[model samples]
Each structure stands twice: as C-alpha cells, then as structure tokens.
Target: MERIVVVGAGQAAGWAVSTLRQEGFTGEIHVVSDENQIFYERPPLSKQVLSKEATYDSLNLFSPEQIDAFSIHLHKPDRATQIDRVSQQVTLESGKVLAYDKLLIATGSRARVPANTWKDIPNVVTLRDVQDCERLAKRLDTAQSVAIVGGGWIGLEIAATARKQGKTVDVFEYAERLCAR
Candidate 1:
C-alpha cells in the first residue's frame, strides 16, 4: 500500500490527511507532531482561547476516538529531525523512522518576536499556541499594564483581548503603522 507521512500536526496537516482520504488514497497514513495536543484551531488561540472563552478540550479538531476510527496513526510530542530524500525516510527525535511514498510538510509558522525584545521578562508573553494563551491569560490577571512588542495580527488580537480584560495595552511598532508590510 502507498504510505503517506505528514510532518507537523497543525491545521493544514490535519486537513491534508482528511483530503487524502476523501480523494480515495487508501494507504497507510501517519501524522507527526511535536506538540502533545492534537490538531486544534489556531485562530482561537488568540481570541476565544486567550480570553478564557474556550478551553483546550473544546479546541480540538479531531478527538482521539475519531483518529482511531479513521485509522490515522498519530505520533504526538515527537519532532522530526531530518528527512532522507533518497531513502524516503523521516527521522524523528525519538530515534524512530518512517518511510513514506508521499510526504507532506505542513509545519506552521511561529510568532516572530525578536531575540533582543522583552521576551525574557517574566510577565511578557506571546500568543502563539494554547499554552501560550493560557499563560498569557493568567499573567493578564495580575498585569496592570502590558507592552506588546509587535503590531502584527497576533499582537493586535492579544491587545484587544487584554483590553477587554481591563488591562492597559501599549503596542510597540518599529514601522509607522500597524502591521506594516
């Protein structure tokens, strides 16, 4: 059977797997994710999840039962270290290797906070994942004022959420306007 391996367990990766099945590719399917959580909605991380409007349990794109029913093998909390193009094998951090007839790389982008920024501070945080939002929400409870470094979508979204929580937010942008491209 044709074996398909997808590296990264984000929304795109989940969608690709579903699409492959919908397209009638009845081969072995494997999904690898560095995160322990299953594929969940990312947009909510900055909005509902960050604001405590939704919990991690409710943000899941697919439940464990559904994954099992669909026969989609999940390798959570595992990172892909390297890819052997010639041998068609993917090496993981746990010393496990998966060979694939078709491979998909659906790794999502991370929050691009500069290394020199105030990221090292205790209360300062970024809204990227569920854990990040949960931590930031907890910090917002104690933070009187929040200084957001970026003026991008995520920064602005978090700023709005923080503002709703009654915290004063200051957005720091190197460029003239917000989200300057």
Candidate 2:
C-alpha cells in the first residue's frame, strides 16, 4: 500500500505513472503540478499550437476519463515548495503535505529572458507552457512584426509560425549560428 508522489506533471512524470501502472504496481499514484492544465506535450507549444494548427486538446497525454481509470490523484495549480526527506513528504503551496514511499522530481525548466526591458512591453512574451502559448497566439493575431531574442528550437519554431502568418520576423542570437547552445 505504498504511495508514490511525483512532482511536476511533465512528460517524465506522465511516463513514470504510466510505467508504474504498466508494471502492475497497485499503489497510490499522486501528481503535483504548478500548471492548472493536465499533463500535455510541450513541443507543440512552439510549433502547431502557436500556429493555431493544433490545440491543447490534441496534445493531452491522457483524458480525464483515462486519468480517472488509472485512479491517479492530480493536485494542480499548486507547487511543491519543499521536500522533507526525514518525513518522506512533499509540502505544497496549499499547505497540504503528501506522504510518499517514493518520490520523483521532473519539474521542467523555464524560458530565460535576457532583456529585462522586454518585460514591460505588452506583446513581449516568453513561450513556455500552454498559457504562454495562448497569450502569444492572441498577440500574434494583430501583430505586424515579431522580434525573437533567441534562435533555439522554441524560438525558431515561433519564428516559423510568425512567417507562416505573414508577419515580419527578426531573430537575435548571441551565438553565431541558430540553436548553437
């Protein structure tokens, strides 16, 4: 009757849960995520989703029914602020602590904003999760030009989307070549 706690509902967390279930681990599975949305793929955030060719519904890792069938507990829109090794529990921002026999941390990274001045701009955004994607998509609807600070996978994908939408694109990369880092 062990309880497995997974922090971050990214691909790794989803994989961990599915693997446990596939292996016939009849234990309690709990997932904690800061995002309000459920487990979904991240790659599309830059490509199809940004271009309006695909939606989050199409990128869902598992449906609500599927999650329910697995009997997995989802605690979302809340972050795990601390992990107590001695107590074997995860403390969430909601002040709820979940005791666990095993734990997994798969929280993904966030986009870094090199220029602080861009934050003040209404249209300037960092593409990260679903929310950011949606905001950028909306902003792009009436945008005539787009300035991408980086030339990484996400940045390039966004630039492609912008070009497809007939918007002018300017990419700024610190590296000599695109996606060098």
What's the lDDT for all of these models? Answer: 0.84, 0.90
What's the C-alpha lDDT at position 98 in model 2?
Answer: 98
Off by over 4 Å in 2: 115-121
Cα lDDT tens digits, model 2, 1-181, are 9999999998778778888888999999999999988678999989998887898889889888877777888898899999999999999999999999999998988778877887888878998899999899998999999999999999999999999999999999999899998
lDDT of 1 by residue, 1-181 (tens): 8999999887888778778877888899989998888677788888778887888888788777766666788887899999999999999999999999989998888777678566787766767676787788888889889898888778888899889999998999999999886
User: TM-scores of all models?
Assistant: 0.90, 0.93
Candidate closest to the true structure, highest lDDT:
2
